[model samples]
Target chain A: MKENKCCCSKKQKKLKVVNIGLQTFAESLRAQGVTVAQVNWRPPRKLDSEMKNILDDLL
Target chain B: MPVKKVTVQQNRYADSVTLMGILDAVKKSGKVMLAEVQMGTPQNVEVMRKLGFDIPATVNANDLVIALEAQTNELLDEAYKDVIDRLDRKHTDGEETFNSIDEVDPADGWNLCQISLPGEYAAEEAKKAINKGLDVFIFSDNVSIDEELQLKRLGDEKDVLVMGPDCGVGMLDGVALATMSLVREGPVGIVGASGSGAQEVACIVEKAGSGISALIGTGGRDLYPQIGGLSMIKGIKRLCEDDQTKVIVLVSKLADRAVMDKVLTFADGVKKPVVAIFLGADESLFASHKVHGTFSLEGAALKALELCGISCKDFEISDEKIKGIVDSYMKKFSPQQKYLRGVYCGGTFAEESLIYLKEHNPDSQLYFNMATKYARKLDSHLKSQCHTLVDLGSEEFTIDAPHPVFDPELRLKRFRQEAQDPETAVILLDFITAPGVHEDPISPFAKACAEAIKARGGALAVIASICGSVNDPQDIVKCGKELVDAGVILTGSNHQSTLLASAFMKALDNRK
Candidate 1:
């Protein structure tokens, strides 16, 4: 048999995940026993067009 | 007059799922007649004002607004506390949460980032993750085409994978992600643009005793002329390179003509056997290529299984069996019952059902809300025409609320409305079970179906199909049993269910 060389296939090592956005997604991964880092992500504050453009350039 | 209370938490942000959870907890308290928890976006603030709440003008999208209406001040305070407690409990669940992707430790060997944020913020976060050399699976929808192209191009340049902006289902290394079935790992790999379409194929593959190597999602618009099937090409190449994948399956609705030719030509060069199902496209397009083109999702799964040296015999229903079922249903249908109303939680299932209805019953007037050449567009999605098949998970129905898969209230109401119509003969439904969806999605509908049948004295037929594996959090066998007990006809697959509904409609027409 050929060796498993898929992008996800790394010699039988488990995948570590960084889950952003929905909390249930992290919970789902936890239930499956996969190691996960949950990120408490929220939308950035709404900015007007001019202020946003200025910040975009400055950043 | 009812007492109304409003609170705006400054500079606070919560995902839609969290806010919906808080709202559910508040409503369950039974102390308030009206309760709403939403971000203070301009549209939401306007809605709050229309509902007779005095929302301050300073409230912005970053604020968390909770509004409640109770009979007394005491009850109002209690309901408000329940919302706060639920929100606090969510925050304090002891998961060691991070603030952003930048905070994620690179030394932890994290291989992937799964994003489900709002579209406006998703692209930026995805870019950050891609820059970190982590493969991204974006579950958010509404991302602009230019953003998707830019992200895919960046992914190519970085030598990483970008799955979707609206991609909902994926399985990598036997691990299911966001709304996918828990199928065992094996030789067949899938690359799909339709969430529910891929899900149906995965569930069917598992049910037939075969398994999946991976199920890669390429968002919905990956095959458009502008996007040009970027993720799909990447997904196909990855699967082809994977030694575990022996057969590859491609599932999507019809794509742009030039893009379809390009994708098919690319597939023809791959060393592995490929099965393609472009739902509305003719099979002749695959004649010149080495790809095996199928017409239905069930056919796609069975064909993939056949390529892997496995045969599945139980997926299709015989014509004799169909005739018997149709005869039984015709006896119960009243003279006034003449149309089929398909209410579906899975968009792809609805699309497949519409295609099947068109192919089988071509003369029947078909209507849908989604874009399809087989059916005419409905004037308003809220209203269904004759022989209407509506994808309740479409954006129009989900703009203000969660998808029907997560919240069944909208679909339940639509089911009841169709049941009440005297001209409705058969109601076709598709129930999808996943990790994050409602725990017992079918029980509420099963109870409603029982009542509808009793009120009509068993004159209506409700046929349905379940899309999930036994490994899913929801018990598939139990769901099937509940549907059967409620006098609903359950089939082996969505194609079988739609075929049964088409048979019932034709038999009714013959009697007329």
Candidate 2:
């Protein structure tokens, strides 16, 4: 899986990565002050755990 | 003894007869007089009868010959009204028929309006309707850019929707409507610079048994540096936010790599593969990402389906046939005739032709700029000689008329001139016709092309490409064959035409 930040518009500032769990990408993006969501079928566990950890750190 | 060709005015309307039946009647009867078939509903038949034309049980050759000389406008109007009226009464999928815009709620989904209104009326009327909060669906070709920009700006400010100035196929809210609605919905969403390219992708996805979530058309405007893909960028972002969309597809004839990279950077984070197919560009720029770049429009569709793991029924031309056509054309062509001039209806086709020319002759100069200001960037020598690629979609070309697709006359005039130029050896063109195309385009177009070839003494070779249905293939085949008989070569797909043109040029050099 490759990781990159959202660069489409000036207003958007989120880090997004694919082939990883939606939770992880969303969490990273959200931390960067960007809204995040996933529109796919599967979400992996390890990536989901990383997202949960990031959320905890933010809290 | 000698015979003179006499013109007879005939009008025949046959309500029911197989094509073969009509052909047999015409053949037995001799040169056509005028044939008019009223494929209308029973109520419409009543309406047509009220309009005062004789509604015959079957058309005769005498009537067809007369129709050839008689005014076609009145006959065509009657024909259109007949179809609309029939559509009003017919029920599909056991659903009740709904007539007029008042019957359907505009807020529920896209309030589609396909404007084939002539001249300035289409743009003017579409603007009027769009101002009234209507979701405008445009199918007309040759609409002015200024008019389109005004409509687009209005759509942006008023929260009203405007799909295209020349846009074709699209799916809205899971409902397939508009031109080239041949795809089933899948997790993929697409934004295309060309209408046919968009429709082709959707069809490919459907063949894989997958459907499209959203297929946005940026028309030919979005990728031009001035347009900078503004609406497309908006649509992409919106689809990315949608919960149903998984993969995204971006296809265009051309894109500024710098602008594309911005979208690419965003797509890289989406957790899904983004298939980018910019037809005329070299794909080496996107070599790093999961992005799969494709040369041909159909090839992009195939790759997108494959990456999605969708099972696609093979639809595009086979690789062997593509190579064979190229090789054969090359062997027969002379290299000394190297320069190419394209008078195209589709912007993408012209772009593809230039790419082919540039690839073959790296030193070749191209005079193309999406912006009027940058228009000076074009090779002045080529531009002056009309050897430059003239997209009928541009404002300069459409000022007097819309486009060669809808109004082939002006382009044909320019094409004839270019064909005779000693500097020009090849001319590429797009002859598009589909179900919703302008009535009776082929015969007039074929006749013009024949005259041009005859004038040039076949000094210029042409490659005509078409976008139409396979079920009714004869229209293009007939046009292609006619041009071929007149000493001009023709092919069906843009890729095939480009490959053949390139191979021919390359082979000519080898002979040297």
Candidate 3:
């Protein structure tokens, strides 16, 4: 749906992972010498359909 | 008297993984005897209530609940503040953190996203990652089927891989992801719907002197008709086109009849040698197709090894050797001990053992927590019935806390329970060692086994297999040694361990 801005041309490089929701997966990858960005993901607050639509339009 | 307190944070929610970490930290402070940090889901509220916490009736699923017990109200308050502090702590030990996928800037060469959030939120995050051209490996479970279909469809249209809504084990470009062991890079690639099934095969392949090019997990439901084996087909095609992968192995429990046909037909077209293990499927299903079909994990591993031009005769124990081992164990059993109980942390291992035991002893009644055609469902997972195989990784066991692979307390308790049963002649177990699991999962269970054997006057037999490699962080060789030193019979593979347990059961039946 969006342009692939994250695509890397180098295929032989070490894998880069963005681990969301569970720091352990990121830690495990980092322990193995892989490059990882840990995301401290928490559940989003509840929004009704009308509020969600407004937010979606605003964003 | 210990004081118990329940505090609910309205509209504040964290993933179970994060809550588990907070729970551990609070308990380790030694200020609280009983502490639980969980979302206020019905099941979690029920668990807290059972633990003697008085949760408010107004608490809802979106709310965060922290229950604590301590010697005094002061101690309880201190521990409660510690949990809140940990929750408010933003940075995780100097590692860079992002609030959402939008902040992750894909140009940093981030090619993949591994999501382990709660099921309700997993799909939206996965959609964001996929839209950003990042391949996804989801470890979260409980996502609705409609959400899974929508995500897979989006992934298909985007051409980026979607690994799972409940996917656990995976390895890409020589890096183990999620709960997978660190397997060496080599010729074999796997497309599996079952996490533990693929892990077993990968470990067995490594033990057979072969290695893996990739291990792609398609979650547990990808092969159902609703999903149409979307991820599995994509994975098979990707492995087929990859230069490093010379052989492809497909592993899963039996899918819908039409879906199985569709997948095998697709695999049949691939030029590379393919091995399929549709557990409980008749062997004849593969006779018509060019792809090889196997019924057991070991059989699938050996077949893939053979296709790779590797001789794995040493990996297989002769029937005579199995008989000798069985005879030795049978002599130690008392006249009253007759049944076998398998307490497994890996679900696939339990299913494999249940299938094997049922095949050999068709007349014997078998029970499992997960219902199968051959085995009836256990009345209660907390208590093992005769000839029971329990998958402690199932949702029933994992709803309150982390998986048994990460915390062995549940399996250990079940092991002790089964060990004390007078009718349990053989107790079967499977231990998985990987990046994210417990450091030494075998020793505590081994110690418990030793005590149980001593208590039984050496009349009990404990048989187990470890699914890991020498490259894992845990000392696997030492783990095996711990089991042996504790009078536990250790096997090289889960299949062999199950076979030995089955043989012991058959022998006990004959003696009766």
| Per-prediction DockQ | 0.45, 0.01, 0.39
Tens digit of per-residue lDDT, candidate 2, span B1-512: 21112122233222122222443443344333333333333543454455444445443332321111123455444433443343222223242223223333334332334443332445765665566555555655577777777777776665544666666655544433344443444677887767877765665565445667777776666555555565566557656765566677887766677767666666666766678878766766677556667777656766777776765545545557656755654444444454566677766666666666666655444445344321223443225332356676566667668566656677777776676666666677776654334434456656766776666555556777665433222355565566677666666467667776665455444445
Q: Write the per-residue lDDT of candidate 1 for residues B205-321, one digit (tens) a residue.
A: 988888888999999999999989889888998898787889999989888988988998999999999999898888678888899999889999999999999978876788889
Model 1 alpha-carbon drift over 4 Å, by segment = A1-13, A42-59, B1-11, B22-38, B44-56, B64-96, B369-371, B378-384, B399-402
Model 2: docking quality category = incorrect
lDDT of 3 at B73: 92
Weakest lDDT window of 10 consecutive positions for candidate 1 chain B: B88-97
lDDT of 1 by residue, A1-59 (tens): 11222254434556778888888888888888877887766667668899999999999
**Candidate whose DockQ is highest:** 1
For all predicted structures, in order, the TM-scores are 0.88, 0.53, 0.86
DockQ of 1: 0.45
* Better model by TM-score: candidate 1 vs candidate 3: 1
Model 3, C-alpha of B379: deviation from truth (Å): 5.1
The better candidate by lDDT, 2 or 3, is 3
Model 3, A1-59: lDDT tens digits are 12432221124545789888777777788888888887756567778899999999999
How accurate locally, in lDDT, is each candidate? 0.86, 0.53, 0.86
| lDDT of model 2 at position B23 | 34
Ranking by TM-score: 1, 3, 2
